[model samples]
Target: MNKFGVLSILMVLISVLMFFILRGPNADLPLIIIILGSLSLLGIIFAVISKKWLSGVIGVLSNGAVLVCVFFILLAYGIAG
Candidate 1:
């Protein structure tokens, strides 16, 4: 894969790991939103500041995946707990 492909895959992997690894009684909606939103914002910043289109593409794609994960996490939280 190319640079953007690698970065996008890595970002998605890391995001999922973070979601699963940080379970807590603090599984509250507010905390989840804060953390995920902040991370997404950071990704946006990285994309904006990147020197290449590859990096920007990776950032945008990764941000999308992160949003998906956030939705799933919120869904899980709503249905079961």
Candidate 2:
């Protein structure tokens, strides 16, 4: 895989780890959410620019999943709506 692909995968892993870490109380939820959003957005961009098909697709899916989960989590807390 290329540099972008590696970066994309790294972002994916970080986002997932952050998502789980933010699940607890008193964890600065809003800031964590924003960070996660930005990280996933970066992952998506890296994935789009990646030259490898496998990494590109995996990065897109993983990052997209994080974004969707974050959206729903915000909605559940009435923070998005």
Candidate 3:
């Protein structure tokens, strides 16, 4: 696995863990979301630049996971309304 793939996996895991651990009006939630989103985006960019199928797939999955987590966070905070 390339550096992008490894970092992508780490960021995704950290984001998932933070999503579960941080709940109820935590100030860090938005920061975490931003970090996850940025890392995911970077992963996608790296995948594109690298032009590797595996990296691209991993990047897409990682980005999707970040989006899902963001959706849930917004829903939980009633921001979706």
Best by TM-score: 2
Cα lDDT of model 3 by residue, 9-74, tens digit: 666677667666765554576665676667667655665555567866876777676877676766
Order of models, best TM-score first: 2, 3, 1
| Candidate lDDT values, in order | 0.67, 0.86, 0.66
Error of 1 at 76 (Å): 6.7
User: Which scores higher on lDDT, 1 or 3?
Assistant: 1
Worst 10 residues of 2 by lDDT: 72-81
RMSD of each: 4.4, 2.1, 3.1
Model 3's lDDT to the true fold?
Answer: 0.66
2 against 3, candidate with superior TM-score: 2
Regions of candidate 1 where Cα sits further than 4 Å from its true position: 1-14, 24-26, 71-81
Which candidate leads the pack in lDDT?
2
Better of 2 and 3 by lDDT: 2
Against the true structure, what is each candidate's TM-score? 0.59, 0.85, 0.60
Error of 1 at 17 (Å): 3.2
Q: Which consecutive 10 residues in model 3 have the weakest lDDT in total? A: 42-51
lDDT of 1 by residue, 1-81 (tens): 345444544555666666677767666675765677667656656665664677677777788778877777778777877
Ranking by lDDT: 2, 1, 3
